[model samples]
Target chain A: MAEEAAVGCARPTGGPVGEENQNETLQSQETLKEERSMIKVGQKAPDFIAPGYHKGAFVNVKLSDYLGKWVLLCFYPGDFTFV
Target chain B: MSIDSMFVHKMWNDHELEHMVKGGIPYPMLSDAGGKVGTVYGVYDENAGVEARGRFIIDPDGVVQGYEVLTPPVGRNVNETFRQLQAFQLVRETKGGEATPSGWRPGKKTLKPGINLVGKVWKEWKTTDAFD
Candidate 1:
């Protein structure tokens, strides 16, 4: 299910993510191994405090600090990987 | 977020991302030590010791509105993320009085979801309208 969510919007343009219309992308993309992440919609996003790198300095950013604003939290496989 | 430390993020930001985005990423690149943050989001791969590629769109009220998780080979679209953020904001600003149709962009036709709009969406919005 997460793989389906991942592949649909990964397309460059003209397609909304999570739409089942992208049958071609569904087939062309390899089936990924089962995942364990169980994040659900409409739930409170998990909060965390961590050290971050920004513009040549280390800063502490707390998830709660960004309250009252749209937060786009992105995760990737370590550093130096293609975004 | 990933398990990368602050120093690694610094190197990547200075050497790679800045070259790609002119002034580097305009947002903070967080260091998720031990994959703690990723684990809470369920994007952490214990065996791999890294977080899977994932993005969560959290609204101003701190609710998770949208999210995507992908593997390493596939790259997520930044433009699409922006589009979604704008769409979400528009819907919120309108206080749910307006809804964005699929593939909706700013200034495009927005649907006012209601009992009357339950089944007649095709009349108010057309496939061709999305392109206009």
Candidate 2:
């Protein structure tokens, strides 16, 4: 819609452009924030017992195995060059 | 190249593994072959055949102390991860008595609220204050 385009252009940073836009933007942002807030701080992390290829062998790595150590569980979009 | 073949060989090839090791990637890069982990984490993009870039700082007790999930287009900052670790470390050292604000750095002033305290802590903060 032209109105949406105007709003998009007016707010290049994707924030609310006007009073009318504020309500819609806030709603949309809240939905997104909720979806992104899946994991919470100081909560028990989801455990997993999965096979990981380490040193050319399939090894079973479990969340419980790394107990008492800070674990940085990272998920990357694919392995190769596509970021 | 096909996704299956990419997963079979190129995903965890020696050269890539060596490069990651040399680059000082401390943690193991686990492959989410069947997208199960990614699916559970809500980062799996089925059409893309990959998970969205995300990071979780799990504490020693297996609890997720901090979590950050960025959109694919916006890459994560590695240094920020270290900063988060340091912040968490500081908080642990100080017990559950204090919390760091945005852009808070280690060895910097921390907030300790009292009954009489009002407004932002930084506004009345003094350089010579004991908490600083």
**Strongest candidate by TM-score:** 1
lDDT of 2 by residue, A1-83 (tens): 34553321110223334457667668967765555435567788878876554555545678888998888887765444444
Compared with the true structure, what per-residue lDDT tens digits does model 1 show for residues B1-132? 668899888898898878889888889989988887897898876656677788999998889999998887788999889998999999899999999997688878889999999889989887786663
Question: Candidate 2: where is the Cα deviation over 4 Å?
Answer: A1-37, A55-57, B1-13, B20-26, B123-132
TM-score of each: 0.79, 0.67
Instruction: State which docking tier applies to candidate 2.
Output: incorrect
> Which residue pairs come into collision in candidate 1?
A37-B42, A75-B1
RMSD of 1: 11.8
Q: Which candidate is the best by DockQ?
A: 1
